[model samples]
Target chain A: MKWALSLCLLLSVGLIFTPNTLHALPEESGKAELWLTKMSTAFSELNFRGLVVYGDGDHWESLEYRQTQHKGTHLSRTQYLSGIPRTQVRSGNELFCIHSGDHIAGLTPDVFKPLNRDLASKLTTILASYEVGVFSNIERIAANDAVFITLTPKSDDRYAYQLWLERTTGLPLKADLLDIKGDVLQRFQFAELELNVTTPISMFSSSESGHALRLKPTPDRVSSSEASWWPAWLPSGFALQGYNKVSGSEGRQGERLTFSDGLSSFTVFVDHVENDLGPDLTRRWHATSATVRHTRSNTGDFRISVVGELPSVTVSKIAESVTLVDQLASR
Target chain B: MTDRKNESLSALCDGECDELEVRRVLNQFSSDPDLREQWRRYHLLGSIMREEPVSSIDLSEGIMQALDGEPMDEVPARSQTPVETSVAHTAADNKRSRSQWLMSGAVAASVTLAVLVGARFAYDPSALDGSMSGAALVMNDSQSAMESEAISAITVAANEPVVEPLTVANADISAEELRKAQEVLSQYVLEHENEAINANEQGLPTFVRVANFGADNKTAVRKD
Candidate 1:
């Protein structure tokens, strides 16, 4: 009778503790998701300016980053302070590169836009591939108390990310992109920041030298039905985000397909080549990898290149997996 | 599947098959659903054994269906006769086979290299930050030399142009060819960065990349 009573008491403790332990994980992850949502909101709604230091491997540079929310329009200007003289101003979906006092305008849709209004829904999809976590300890960044968060990839196809977001404003004060090996591939940290700073309207205006070149907006989505070439395989979570046909000099025609898994992305370019380009070559620029392969189809020789901030092996696999539509039709 | 076919599949999974065996397995894989399932299972099992993350979702069925919907031309049968072929045809065949061999070798080498690099990084104390630190931090001093050696090995294996900043691959190409490739890659990188600016709410980080690239390009030009 005494042993039975002790067993019952033990069972009660296990039942009570098990529920709390299970609930703890979800609660922590929920808090991380909420912080991400708030960070996304603050990006567009909040106005701030600061000096940022960006580095990758041995390369490092300082830049002045300014953004303002003016009349529901997001305007941002970035100027390099430590390196070559260059300035860029972004207004809505348009980006102007000011070099030598001339503005080269290009339509970069959603360049500085807020995360999709349906971010709550999209976060579910992101969480499927990444394990989002909020560190319990607080950290100081740019003189502000910050909440550290990590978005680690579930697979080796993508790199990992760490962010230190300001506690009060939820603004990311420091960000780091870590490789699969956990090395810091790239980092962006604010050195000094000021919130709610008013900027002159002229700062966002185009240079007095006027626009030297204006580029047309890329066609948003060239449907799969219209695509002549497509990748036979992609990293699990990646989805086709954009597709467009491009014409290069000498009448070379090419198609560009962009794939993204919410946080990471890669682009495959298939171009008609006049001659064979020998063996496949792989290149790495900091975190980005570019792999090129030459393939022959019934129609002609084609050059396929996969470029992205991914591992070289992943990029090479993507390049090799590109299949010609006509070739597939005839297989 | 026959016992012989099963043996071939296993050999292929181990990457020990010759060209003819690979071709045979691939042909069978296209037609036999059972073989496809077995292949998937073998891969899943291998991944599990290697301690790699494996996703339960399989999209191969949908991919196969999509391919089946396409209008396929009947494959021509191999002729027994030693018929004369055009020089171009023979050269193309040789090139295709060589390319396939190179690709296969590269994939194998890269997979092994990735495992080595990953293992090294996994145990390196410096890889983890203060928040991630625990028992790993205790071994930092002892492992510093190993970490440096591993990093150098990775750099060499990746063929990173540590000497020439902002240059593309250090292949045996003319300076002009290298320049052209660099310009094209830069443009692609910039375009990709623009598209992914807001990906995962990473607008500022992506912008920083653009700015960095711009500065590097200018510096490269100045040096040249």
Candidate 2:
């Protein structure tokens, strides 16, 4: 009894100094959420110059950029670092894409269509899909200090990401997209960065502003009266965003359809004639990911191709539904 | 008997004991409560190094020396400091190796795909054949029979019955032939665009023209 009592006393004394596991601490998660919120806000409010290296598959290219925020307006200029003598300067809704080699002026109604609020929402959703975590210490980036955070995706559909954001401004210093095996599929890093610089208004003006603004011919936006005869088995989360009807030689006719998942978009083209001849085009192009599938409708023989980043099943379902409706018909 | 029970309790805390022994200790601890407190104390001793500063021995200098391989004999207080060290040091090597393993796996997959494609086309004889005409397919050039004839000759020389390589090889065809192919592709794209617009005017979707753009940003040019 005496030894038992002594053991109990010693154990109770030791219990007073025991430390808990890191998994039990709430502070690390707090740090992750705080860092991401600051990053999102800073991207919209801060003016920072940094190199953006965009890559897909084996191709890689770098762009030099300058951005300035004044009052409520943001202006940006970008020049390709590679072979092309091209420069893009944007001010609000206007974008001037200049090709120095051809002396051609490329004009667009809205240069930075990606700066919309919907894009922000999409990015928020994308980030939330990952396990948010931080590294142990900060690292220097382009002469400025930055903090690194690792985000591991919970699903296979998306890739993991490691981002280094500026410690002071929350601007992204570098980003790497890693596959399931943790190999980097793509990387975007800043070669140089200038934070909070005073940019002149003239910097936003394109050198080709005096030249003619050549507008690419807008596509005809007309839907076929035959859309009513189509079926309705589109994939979940896919919404019809656009459609048009076209008439070609020998009365070769088709209707094109567009779909969007609120972020990534795709298109489907359904060509038909009042004959038994099946679709002549049944192939796919890597440049567009357009998969052609042919089917027969009571009114005509149709050739359909689904084009987008989505799975082939989604495209197939949408392609199966090309109906024909009279102009004045009601349900 | 009491010492043996405490030893078992410690083993349970370390996750070395069987479930039956764990249950027995848990039951006894639940009734007495003090044994449970003792088990936690032993684990804490091993974990506390993660959080607190050491006081009695020069364990920190020992750790620093172990990490950086510098002798800390110059420190005068080595004898007085108590060591408060963490077991996490032992696990660092395991974590680093696991991350490296994952990185290598991903690289292997991508690299294998690249190598296979490269090797398959490395000795493409079509590009070297003189009769094989090359065209910059994106330019609006006319596709004459000579370009077709050149493609056939090259295909025959390569002895590959597949026509897929022919299409790919034609991408580098002469500027004029490339112009014609670009016109064909552009016409196809415009046809689809026209269809989308017509559908939209009738209250349908209008977002089809630029929907599926791959990394290839090449556009078909029609020169007058």
lDDT of 2 by residue, A251-300 (tens): 55556566644333566666553433222222222122334444565565
lDDT of 1 by residue, A186-233 (tens): 656665578889988789887854232222343455367778898887
Name the lDDT value of residue A239 in candidate 1. 77
User: DockQ of candidate 2?
Assistant: 0.02
* Ten contiguous residues minimizing lDDT sum, candidate 2 chain A: A104-113
Show where candidate 2 strays beyond 4 Å. Answer: A1-40, A101-118, A123-140, A144-162, A177-185, A209-265, A269-290, A299-303, A310-331, B1-218, B221-224
Per-model C-alpha RMSD: 26.6, 24.5
Cα-lDDT of candidate 1: 0.56
TM-score of each: 0.56, 0.45
lDDT of 2 at A143: 53
